[model samples]
Target: MNIGIIPMRYAKALFAFAQDKGMEETVYAEMNQLARSFAEHASLKTILDNPVLKSKEKQALICTAAGTQVSDIFVRFIEMVLHHKREKHLQSIALMYQDLYRKARQITIGSLVTATPLSADEENRMRKMLMMDKEGTLEFKATVDPEILGGFIFGIDTYRLDASVATQLKRVKNQFMDKNRKSL
Candidate 1:
């Protein structure tokens, strides 16, 4: 069986089920939390994959990792996943559900990384400028990363614009090295 197919199938079912129950938004939030838990805790996968852990225990762990409280639809989905011994793909399922939700709702996810934090006005201006050419609602998140040295990196969906000083310096360094090699 294809590994990717399993998560997609499960996620599609969960998305449809949540929509039918009018809990899609709640489930989406829970899935995002669950996905973040998986990313932040590498041991989570190892614990879920442990053979000694009972289904109930794993279920409890997953529910706790999701958030303070999850929707009934999410709980039922987790039960179904545990019942089918698909706990190993829980992370992927959560991420897939998020993707499905975002696509269905026509939400565009974007991120801005800069050496320094932008003021609220600046952030709003940036968001407005970026949204000018894009369709649908934009969910913009700004993060600070001093490693970039200066300037900013903007990304919307799969497209990324890297104008950071560090990256430019690296490109210049690479070009110098190549020239030196050619001259040698």
Candidate 2:
């Protein structure tokens, strides 16, 4: 049983179930929070990852710590993971579940790598362009990359539009070589 397969399958199923129950938003938020918590607390994650811990005891401790912050359905999901000794896959499950949420909501997530921090106006303009160009709602996450030199690169899903100065310089260099060859 590959961890990735199990988590992704379960995540899709959970997303479907939550959507049907009209709890998709809430469930998505919960999974996101859980993922963030797991990231912030490495020791807690280590405990969950430990295979020697008895499933029942682990479930009890986790359920207690989770308190009322997570929904009952999510708690049961956690219990099931513990029962199967698959707690280590929780973060993956959460991430997959978020992907499901985004798909269902008609929201597109993208990344923008820029040479410098975008001004508020630039950020808004980019977001507007994405929204107008895309078929659905756009959610852009911007990352600063000093190496880009001057321009920006936008990526939506697997589609990338490279407008960076680095790419521009490469294209210019290629054109120069082409021109030089014609004169030879």
The best candidate by lDDT is 1
TM-score of each: 0.96, 0.70
Q: Quote the lDDT for 68 in model 1.
A: 94
Alpha carbon deviation, residue 158, candidate 1 (Å):
0.7
- Alpha-carbon shift of residue 81 in model 2 (angstroms): 1.5
lDDT for each residue of candidate 2 in 1-184, tens digit (9 for 90 to 100):
6668989988988888787778888788888777776677777778877778888777765654444466777777887777777787877888899888888788898889998898989889888887876687877899999988988898987799999999999999999999999999
Per TM-score, the best of the predicted structures is 1
User: After best superposition, candidate 1 residue 181: deviation in angstroms?
Assistant: 2.3
Tens-digit lDDT track for model 1 on 42-133? 99999999999999999999999999998788888889999999999999999999999999998999899999999999999988898898
Model 2: CA > 4 A from native: 1-4, 36-47, 54-68, 162-184
Residue 123 error for model 1, in Å?
0.7
Number of clashing pairs, model 1? Answer: 0
